[model samples]
Target: MRFSRVVEASGAVAATRSRTRKTAELGGLLDDATAEEIPTVVAWLSGVIPQGRLGVGWRSLTSLTPTPSESPSLTVAGVDDLFVRLAAAGGPGSVALRQGLLTELFGSATESEQDFLRRLMTGELRQGALAGVMVDAIAKASGQPLDLVRRAHMLTGSLPETASLAVHGGAQALAGVGLQVGRAVAPMLATPADSLADAVAALGPDLVVDFKLDGARIQVHRRDDEIAVYTRSLRDITAAVPDLVEVVRGLPCRTVILDGETLTLDADGRPRPFQDTMSRFGSSGELADDPNGLLRPFFFDCLHLDGIDLIDRPLSERLAALTTVAPGMRIPSVTNPTVAEAERHFDAALAAGHEGVMVKSLAGPYAAGRRGKAWQKVKPVHTIDLVVLGAEWGSGRRTGFLSNLHLGARDPDGGPPIMVGKTFKGLTDALLQWQTDEFGRHETHRDGHTVYLRPEIVVEIELDGVQRSSRYPGGVALRFARVVRYRPDKTVDEADTIDAIRALLP
Candidate 1:
């Protein structure tokens, strides 16, 4: 298929607010795609690259200003092949090789295609073609069940592969996708509840309340002695987390898949700041021996234990299996607690230096990769991760630093990040200097007062709540939002969505 067709579909998807319209536009595009072109098309429309990061930052892309072609002739395969070559270019002279390839690709693209390529290469392609809508599109195009397509995508954790399967092998092939011992599946996520009482009321008394630690989410897979640890985004950090590997390996089960969190604890056994844990978790090499820096694993759910797959089973059954195998590593929890008892547990968790308590329904099955209402998190303060859109230059006492931050939330429909609010509060002098230096590296353009940036940095913001506003694109603005911390462990994709921000509205 032609690259222009995909670009047109993306534009169409972004131009509409109705999800059905967006799905229809994408479905039509997918229907015309050849089997060989399905993966690339699906990945692009889903706002990602099959080759992952190509190391092509905004600076490199902005340096090249190729004139647009008059007519469209570029094919999806041709563009994908160039991206592959660009991703592979990494040596003494690889920079220039990548530059040459990009220039060639962009030079052949038309004006609209050039804009699409620019946004895509910089991870700013927000065309409402998110994974959920694309899954529907795949089903619509291939005449398969939406449940089957969604299950295949969840099990494989690759939308492109799922799209290919739906288009080629049909429902039977999608049904064949199952949990693999060595592979990482998307971890189930929790929705937010206003309070512990609210959660108890919503989920009823048959609930399991566990302490929600302020740490990184990990999914561990063990087959005999071999062990693998993956982040919530499914990135493998097994080699960097050997301590965790040994812990999982010590389990009695021959084959198991466990979901949990990992973090370093202080001398007093309290969890340290999240940055310290992520620094070690995101490392590429073996870490030095540090007593406080050693990452410890805490299991919460068992997806697969021995020969039994517990994902389809209720949470009560899965928790039983998890306790049988990794009893000591289980997160501290209370089951079937009354509302008053759950409140006490929440208080205890807060007093113990944890973020909050997770109130989970006992009868809900593991809804992997989906943030359903079966699990709810209640915290004392509202904290959210948002993208750093731009920063204003400081004045007076804060002069010479980037003081005020422009924040944005991810659009659930896959459009560009929606500006929610800005804040100059909660920033220390040290943080000011750090952001000034850091934001410069990501600078796309600058005005007299602010430096606009690429939507790559994720910062955690603390807010009183959200209020409806006409100033922001999402029709809601954060109230008294302040910086909590910079989340280096998260990506724009993982940042809280506008729908989440809207949920906070009063």
Candidate 2:
């Protein structure tokens, strides 16, 4: 397939707001892709690179102004080959080599293709070809069940691989994909409930309510003596989290996959600030030197145990398995609680310096990678993590500071961040200075009053609610939004989606 075909499909997907139209366009593109070309095509359309980051930055892209070719001649394989070489170019003079390669590749493309390549390389491809849409597209192209494709995607945690399987091998191949004890599967997610009572009402009385700690999500995979720790995004941080590794290594079961949260706690046994936890979590050094910064793992769900896969099992059975293996490390929870009892549990979690409570149905299976109502979270305050889109200059007491922030919610369909609202509230003087210094590092452009930024910074915002409006692209506006704190622990991909914000409408 020609690279131009992909560029055209991406453009068509971006030009339409209707998800049906976008899925059709992507499915058509997939229908034209060869089996060998499926993986690369799927990854590109999903706004990611198969080779990961190539050390290319926005500055490098802006520095080159190559004159595009008159015709489209670049093949998909040829472009992928260039990316491979770019990823391999390193050591001395590697910068120049990479620039030369990028220039050569861009110079061989037409104007539209150059734009596509630039956006693709810079992680700015904001088409609507998200993982879910792509899964549907794969199902459409391969004539397979959507559930089979989605299940394969969840189990494998790789869209490109799932696409290839669905396209080449069909439903039989997809059905064969299962939970591997050593490999990390996508973690199950929870939906936000309006309140504890509402959550209990939705999931019924036969549910377990556990504390929702404000910490990083982790999946521990233990196969005999080998233990690996992975984040929610599936990045391996086994070396960085030795304490967690040791804890999992001590579990009774030899082959087990545990889903849990890891956080740094103070001497009084209260959870520390999220930033402190991430600071230690992201470090690759030996944490034994700092006793106060050690992370403690709190296992909540057992996905597999003793050579048995329990993802298809009920939550009650999984909890029973977890209790048998690591009862001391299990999160505090109460099973079959009434609405009032669940309310008390929610209060207790907040009192313990945690975020809120997670109400889970006892009979629901571990629906990995899907945020269904089987698990619901209820918090006392309404808070969301949004991306920093831009900021306006401040005046008066906050002179010279980038005070008023432009906040945006993630588009669940993988389009660009949708603007929901703006706020200068809840920012302290120290925070103002920090934003001024940090926003400068991520600046993409500047106008007379505001400095636009790349959507790289995630900020937790507390809002009273949301109101329907036409002022923003999301067709809603935030009500009394205030900055809670900057969430360095989160990426833009983890930010709250526009659909979530809209769900707050009264």
Candidate 3:
């Protein structure tokens, strides 16, 4: 297949906003691909170039790159290849090559489309595009139902498997199996709930509440004595976490998959910052001598045990099976009738210095890759519903127009506006301009569309924690927060209160 075909498919996928349409188009492309060519094609399409991960990456910025005279054949390369190329072509010449590639093929694309391509190369396609969206596109192309494709994805770790299944067994084969939990399996992202009360209420009476630890979610897979620990995104960290490997190696079951979090606990047994735990993932040095460096696996859910698949099993059954394989790490359950008892558990978790707790519905089967109301999280931090007042222009591609935002909360006491923290992390270029214009129209004043807002619009904002700051009027500041979304339904007066902010402070 020609590179142009992949480019065309990319364009088609980019042009369509609907996930279903994108999935169908990608599916069609996959179906047409020859059986022998599937892996290579998948490799090419997924941009699995030689260097490692994909594309001309950030690492390329510091290194040297190939000259025009030495331009290698563009047959097919993985992410690692492009990244290395970019690294080698470190100066203006390499940048020109990347820009040339985007402009050469995707030049016909709309400005937004082109921006999307660039973002894709940079490894930040923040239009909320995910692997699942592409799965949907592949499903449509293969004439499979979207749900079937999604389920197949839960079963098979690779998109190529989904493609092969669709080509052979059709949609029916895709939907035949559900997600298997515990046996150290990967899970889809969990939707966060505000509190245990909120989670239990959403999940209902028959629920399991687990300690939401300060750690990283890990999928442990054991086949015989060999064990592999993969992060949620499937990055293998088995070698880096030697302790985890040893722990799993000692499991009772011969073959199993378990879902749990791994953390570095302080001497007092309190959870540490995520960075500390994540450091163990791929450290260049030897494992920390501290047993605290050990990845204490807490088995909350089980997908498989021995050779049997437990995807169809209820949460209760799965939990029971989970305990049999790994007893110490079993996530504790609370069956108190009232919400108040759950609150006591939440308080206990907080007292233990954990981030919060997770409440899972006991009767539901594990919904892999699904962010339904099945699991909920409760945190103590106060999330503000503020408005985007104005923005500063960003650098590089966002050279002009509003980039970072001036978010504010309406004074409940009818006082002047309170300035919260600013962030440039979440906004896409398109989102930047859209906000600029939107905030500009509601602009009380404007300096080239870096307009101040009416404070009428409200947005939900999440922060890691609150810190004391004299820089802003609220005497408190948001720590590392980005926009969740615009809460259009909320009015200025309806925003969270100062008391709420105080409650969130450390």
Candidate 4:
């Protein structure tokens, strides 16, 4: 396929404010892709290279190149091999290579497409197309079912792997292999309910209510004495979170993967505001010298213990196993047999300065990367899950780092993510690394220091509140908003809706 096609698609996606329209355009492009060139097509459209978690702009840059470096020397087989190396390389070297690739592609692309590619490569594209749509595009290109692709990619945390499996073995093979591998799904997410009654009505009576801590989501993988800490996006932050590494080192389990949240607390021993924890690291300025702020881990669900994968195990079983292995690291468990008791726990968490509660279904298995009614969140107000559509360039203090994020909520019926507002808070060093690398990839266009992205990543956003807005779409605005963390498991389709925003009216 010509690099022009990919550049054109990027432009189309960016021009499209609606997720459905953007998805359809990309899906059409992928559908036209040849069987032998499916991988290349997917890579170009996603602006990613197969190895590791590739960035968007880097991929776009490479697409324009007449002949970018191919993985002919890769001795290791399968999709995981490429991504693992790429993700591990999380530094300037990998970033520079990607930028070069985009430059090459943009040069080869047509005049119109070049403009689009430039925007995408610079992280300025405001299109609502997200990875969820891209997953659909990948499935269409490979002639696989959407659900099949979603399940496979979600389980492995690598879309390239899913594409390879689809082409090599077909959708059935991907499904079969996924079932045989039997890994846990990512943690389930919640669709905000109008009230507790609505949530209960949606979930019925078989739910298990757990206290939701106002902190960062963490996935801890422990192998014997070796342990790795990953954010919900699957980005490795083991080094930035040395305290978590130390705690996991003492765990009795030989090989294990657990999911939980991390938070920083004030002198009062209360979980600090989500932003306080986020502000501890990831700044280009003098953040390293700040010794007062730190993050602490609070375990929730155990995905693996020793060699056995416990994702299929019930929540009750996983919690029991978690407690037995590391009681001190375990997040406080809320076992309320009644709704009133659960409400009390929610109030108590608020009183303690924590966010709210995460209600889990005791009988459900650990759904590794999917969000469902299995877990529901209840906050006292002032938070929402938003999609990052674009970002403004930083200046002075924020020169290199992202200054502010353009946020949006889910649009029902496959519409565009409605712009709510922008934020520049709730970031740590690890968070900063992830964003810079990620935003760099999504750069559609940049003015001075700002990069724009194709609203593909969904973030858990917290803000003071919403006010009427005439400057942006959706007729509303979010004030003092910032990212809590990136929501890798979620798709733009699953983001908070305008109706949910309307509910925030004071």
Candidate 5:
């Protein structure tokens, strides 16, 4: 198909507010695409390349303002090949090569196509239809069950390939996609409950309350001597932590995909700060040679063991299978505890310097990537990780420091974050100094006392509750919001979203 068709469909999808209309538009595009073009079409609509980052910067795209053609001439295959070349161009004089290719590609595109390409290349395509909506569109177009497609997408961890399968091979093809040992399935998520008593009342007496550690969520996959560890976002970090690889290798099974948390602990066996855990994943992680700095894994749920996939089984069955393999590494939990017993357990977890307790339903299937009432997390305070949109300058005692942070919740649609509220309430002098130094590096614009940021920082905020509001794009505001700690471990994508914030509304 011609690339203009996609540009037009993108514009139509963005223009409509109705979910039905957006799905229909996206379905129409998918219906018209061939089997070979499905990957490119899906990737473009999702606002990413199949090859991942191509090292193309905003300057490279904006500087070359080439003239556009009167009509569309580029095919989907031609555009896909150009991106492949762009990703391949690197090291020594590759800059000019990328520029020449982009120039030619843009010069051949129409005005509308050029605009779409610019947004797609720069990762700024804010179309209302994100991955969730696009999955619905694919299901709509292919006449398949939404749940089946969603599960396939989640397990495969590739919407582009899922689209191709649904389009060409139908529901039977989707049924074939299962949890692979080496590949990371999207982790099952939990929704916040009012309290432990409320969660027990709702989820029933057979609840298993496990300690929720304030550490990095890691999904470890081991096959023979080889092992791969992925973060919440499914980015591989096997190269950084060799010690973790050795730990998972000791499991009884030859092939196992285990989901759990990893953290560095003090000499007393208390968990360290989350920042220290995350430091072992990013840059400078390989050089971290502290004797106490070990990412201890506690297998909470095993998705796959040996040659069998356990995701289809209930939590009870999954836990049983986990016991057969790595019983000692399993997260500590109490089953069907009374109110007093649960409280004692919660207090014990707190005393151990952990975050809180995660109460889970024993009958629940894996339910990968779905956050519902099936699992409930209870923290000491109503704390959530929010993205920092901007901050204001401090005055008097706190002069020359960044204060009064503008906080936002992540949007579900992958657009700009929704502004819920702002807070400078719980920040200390040390935090103020840190924010002043770090935030300026991400500053986009500064006006008067406020300096706007690129929404890259995630800060943990404690709020009383949410109230309906006239201000804020989310149509709700956080009440009694205060800073807890800066969540350097979280990305803008991992922070609590606007929809999650609204769930606490009174």
Candidate 6:
């Protein structure tokens, strides 16, 4: 198949707001694609490389100003082979070789193909139909059930591979996907509940309320003495923390898959700061400096044990297996707690320096990577009115409009406002139009994607908390921040200060 066909399909998919249309477009493309070309289409549509990140920078991409071909001739295999060469470029004089490949690839692509390839390489493909919509497309093209494809994709953590089996081998191929001991699957996610009462009322008496700790997540796969630990994003950290490898090896079972959170505890057996846990987990060299700061795992759910795959089993059965494996290390959870009892557990978790609590259903099997009613997280978020320092031009569906606001907290020292973070979430088309009109009048300067403003617009923002960071001028950044509303009545002087944000950091 020609690479230009995939580019045209992507544009057609992005030009609509209908999921049915997006799925139909992608399904049609997949129906016409060869088996060898399916994975390339999948990766290019996702704007990611088959081998993961290619380490290509924006400067290098813009430097190769080759004139594009007038007609489309690049095949899917041709592009994939070019990516192979790009990924292989490393060590001494790799710069020129990489640039040569980049120039060659662009020189053969048409003008439209060049734009598509550049955006795809730079990860600017904001087409509304990436992974989620592609999943539906694969199911449509394969004539398979959506749930079956979703399950297979979640289990494998790779849509291209899943699509290949679904397209060529059919349902029996998807059924072959099971919980592998050493392979990492996507972790189940939770939705947000309005309150404890709402969560209890939704999941009912048959629920498990577990302490939601603020730390990095780890999925441990054990096979005798060979153990592997993967992060929530599926990156293997088996070599980073040798202590964790030892802890998993100590488990009684010869083979098991455990899903849990990893945190650093202080000498008093209390959870340490989140920064401390990240420092240990994010390290690529030697372990943490302080021995007491080593990462500790608290098992919560078991997916595989004793040669049995418990992923299709209910949470009740999974928890039972988890208790048999790591009783002492399991997260503190309650079964069918009353409103009063649930509040007490919530208070106890906060008092113990943990986050809030997670309310989960008992009868449902684990829904990997799905944020449905089966699990709901009830974390307390802090809200504050912040000043908008700037806004960036949107892309794809949001093109020609201002999006991704630069948030700032008022400096208590009476200096200029300090930038804390940027967010483009929780925005509507009406809000985007209003922001573009209002902020364009206050434009002070323009730099690439960002347009600086006069720092007069006050907007209310909600966040999980602030984290220690050097990226922002305030020495901290907001985690999971989203715009709540425009504070039209509030002035810049009334906005929350940098000191207030720092106090929220743990």
What are the Cα lDDT values of the candidates? Answer: 0.90, 0.90, 0.64, 0.65, 0.86, 0.84
Q: For model 2, what is the error of residue 243's alpha carbon versus the real structure, in angstroms, after optimal superposition?
A: 1.5
Writing each residue's lDDT as its tens digit, candidate 2 over 1-506 gives 99999999999999887889888999999899998998899999988899998989888998889898999999999999999999999999999999899889989999999998888888888888888888989899889999999999999999999998998889899999999987889888898887888889889878999999988899999999999998887888898888888888888877999999999888899998887887776686587565768999998999999899999999999999999999998899999998888888888998999999999999999999888789998888999999999999999999899999999999887778999999999989988999999899899999999999989899999999999999998999999999987877567888999988988899
Best by TM-score: 2
**Residue 169 miss distance in model 2 (angstroms):** 1.9
Q: Give the poorly placed runs of model 3, Cα more than 4 Å off.
A: 20-129, 169-185, 382-506
Report the C-alpha lDDT of model 1 over 227-313, residue by residue, as the tens digit. 999998898989989889888888989999999999899989899988788888758747547788889888899999998889989
- For candidate 3, lDDT tens digit of each residue in 77-191? 3322344554455455756786554333343443433443344454333231245665665666566787777777777766666667775778677766444432233374456
Q: Among all windows of ten consecutive residues in candidate 5, which has the lowest summed lDDT? A: 282-291
Candidate that beats the other on TM-score, 4 or 6, i.e. the better one: 6
Candidate 2: stretches off by over 4 Å: none
How would you order the candidates by TM-score, starting with the best? 2, 1, 5, 6, 4, 3
Per-residue lDDT of 1-506 in model 5, one digit per residue for the tens? Answer: 99988999999988876778888999999889887897789889987788788878877777878888998999999999998999999999998898889889999999999999888887667676677888998898789999889989999888898998898889999999998878888888888878989888887777789999888888999889989999887889998877788888777878989899998898899998776787788754454567678788887998888899889888888898989998899887888898788888899999999988999889888888777678999888898889999999988888889999898998776667899998889888878988899997777789989999877789999889999998998999999999878876566767888989888887
* Residue clash pairs of candidate 5: none
lDDT, residue 106, model 6: 95
Q: Which regions in candidate 4 have their CA more than 4 angstroms from the true location?
A: 9-28, 31-36, 49-107, 125-129, 176-186, 197-206, 273-276, 279-294, 385-417, 421-472, 475-506
- Backbone clashes, each candidate: 1, 0, 40, 49, 0, 0
In model 5, how many backbone clashes occur?
A: 0
lDDT of 4: 0.65
